[model samples]
Target: MGWQIAAASAVVVVLAGLTTLALSPLLGRGRPEHGGGPDRDDEILRSTLLVAGVIGVAIAGVAGFLIARRAVAPLGEALARQRRFVADAGHELRTPLTVMHTRAQLIARRMEPQDPALPAMRQLLDDSRVLGEIVDELLASAVLTADPGRGEPIEVRALLDEIARSMAVLAQAREVQISVAGPPGVWVTGSRVALRRALAALVDNALGHTPPGGWVQLAVDVRGEHVVLAVTDSGEGLAGLDPAELTRRFARGPRAADGPGGRRFGLGLALVQEVASAHGGTLTLGPAPTGGARAELVLPIRS
Candidate 1:
């Protein structure tokens, strides 16, 4: 009777093992079975295969993730290096351009007003200045794009005021009324130089696009933990552009070339957007209340 009971228990164990093996293939939890599932050996093979499959899937996932990371790293590094190269090249080119401009200016001053060389010299000087402006813009853009992680605490009000004052001359030349209305001493965490450049670029854009006798207003207001700096130009506003598109690179609005001083517009606002982002800020463009376009730069306040 004891022998009979032992035999029955062994049969039950064998049947249970066979059931697991038979279901393994249907569940896709096993590797290739080397033998039929009716036997105990087949059951062991199925259990081993199931464990191996899980291990294989885990290994594949890890390998795939590593490959993806490796692929992205080089592209990011290349973009950074390219931006640095552009900045360096622009900086180096500025010196020679400045010398050429000076030489042209001197030639124009020395020549008689009616002389044929006078027009040529004047044109050269004008071209040189334009080239210099382009180089400055390129250098600024490259620097801003390459390093969005570089910013320090800055005083917003003073910076905007300073830029406003500096651009006052150009605004005057175009007979455009320019003003700044904002409180002082608002502190923000961003690269001071980059912040200044961003404000100047926006102000310049406004002054450029505002029709002669029109007004360009710059205002900075503290909204909770964010500082909002806005520049408005009273000229033909953006051509029904979606506000979101304004932040895109090279997205020049139709009004860009139509400002007070007959402005040559391209990439100015793009740089402003880039600078804002580099400082972990937001930029927006919309229609001003005075029937023109407005640009706003919102930056986080430094604690």
Candidate 2:
């Protein structure tokens, strides 16, 4: 489009200049020589051609800008619709997944360990729970991508404690101890739901990598003008994997896909990173002191 506009503008300018020159001689030919004959006519022609060229270029530029904007408008609308669809689909799936998980758990409770169907029931329950988590992550990603988060003061310590408590059951089932530690009353500004989901993703990723009987820790603290929420596990730290690469959607480390929790879809860390950025924060990944991976979501402390 740009090239075409330039070409057309060039052609118009050239034609205008040619027409002015062609008319100059005729217009000046019979005029009195003393009345500023051909020389004055030539000056008028040059000035007219120059003005015409400027006007033509200006018009072309304006047309090109409007054309480019029009061309991209539909693409923007399409992307927005796609994000909305993903978010809506994920939200709608949550209820059914919760129902299925509840039913599967109820069946498991009624079945004897020796029953032939017990294992299958347990597997179904696990699958349903994992599926629910995936849906939640999907919704989080869609929301973060589509809209900027509303930053409001959130109680950081309480949030971490809630997450730790909620995830305790899963940690125990995997024989990995999970703990939370933080000072009280520390606050940050961000969307509470988004921040909670980000923390959940970090904890889930940590638990997935930690070995049986290993420990995972969630800690919140204030450092200078920032609030930090860190999730560290007792698993092998990053294993020489690039932290930046792991933050990319669907990018996983070497052991990320080989855990007992089954294969991770690799959206967890990516969602964490997105949430952090939306809240004017940073997500850092590094080796923990205890030889495990440490993921930190750092946000500016709301004054």
Candidate 3:
């Protein structure tokens, strides 16, 4: 609708300008002089109309732009609403999941070694913790999108240890060794929860791909002004796949089904990529020196 009005205004302005130009000579040649100039009433009228038309078209263009923006305002509001909902839902879920995980851990601790339900309790704890992390990742992503977020000095070595501990349940179940070997006292600046989520995703991906009796190692290094957290596995080394393609959503490797976890839906790498981007970092995928794949997340050293 706005476009139609603008087009019509443009056409009218052009016609008015042409009419004034084409009839000016004829108007000036006829009739007696009027004031200091020859009679040119019709020319003057057309010229005035041409100027008015130009002004009218300019006004219409501005109005059209406003109308176009107004028409899409609802879409902008809907997106904002969606972000708010995600943030709120993540906050609401965190408390209950935390309680469930704590209670499950307590019960598992109370059970004896021979207790029949101990394994189930431990598995429940693992499942609940994973779910809570999923929520945290989604929530933190949303919050960081809204605000780049404040930076905290996170010890890189400690962060790796935390991920190793959190992922131990899955690694143990799969019979894959999890090792964290990095120099201590190395620190970086970022959101702890988000960074942990990213590292956990990497470890989870490694554990899923590595066969039972294999191993995954998390290592840290300080190179120049950046800190690198690397996760290396002992599975088929990326199957010669493109690293960029792997980071894309729903992109699975050619041998996705060959791993212990079977075919993955492929959100893990994408999530890690998002976390890295939010923290002003980079996620790189490459073949390990020995075998299998290595995923490295690099971030700037705390300023």
Please name the candidate that would achieve the greatest TM-score relative to the true structure.
3
Report the lDDT tens digits of candidate 3 across residue range 1-303. Answer: 657766767765676677566666655566467654333565566666666577666766776777778778998899789879998999999999999999998888899999998888889998998899779777867766666545667899998998999899999999999999989999886778889878887888788778889999999998999999999999767766788887888888664555443324278888888888877789999999978889999988876
- Tens digits of per-residue lDDT, candidate 2, 1-303, equal 667666666766776677666666666575666676677867767766766677666766776777788779999999899889988899899999999899888889999979999888888988998798778766766765665453557899999999999999999988999998988888876677778888988888788778898999999888999999999999766777788887788886554367533224378788788778867789999999998888889988878
Sort all candidates by TM-score, best to worst.
3, 1, 2
TM-score of each: 0.59, 0.57, 0.61
Question: What lDDT does each candidate get?
Answer: 0.74, 0.80, 0.81
Q: List the residue pairs that clash in candidate 3.
A: none
Better of 1 and 2 by TM-score: 1
User: Which candidate leads in lDDT?
Assistant: 3
lDDT of 1: 0.74
What's model 3's TM-score? 0.61
Cα deviation at 252, candidate 3, in Å, is 1.7
Give the per-residue lDDT of model 1 (tens digit) for 280-303. Answer: 788888889887888889988877
Order the candidates by lDDT, highest first: 3, 2, 1
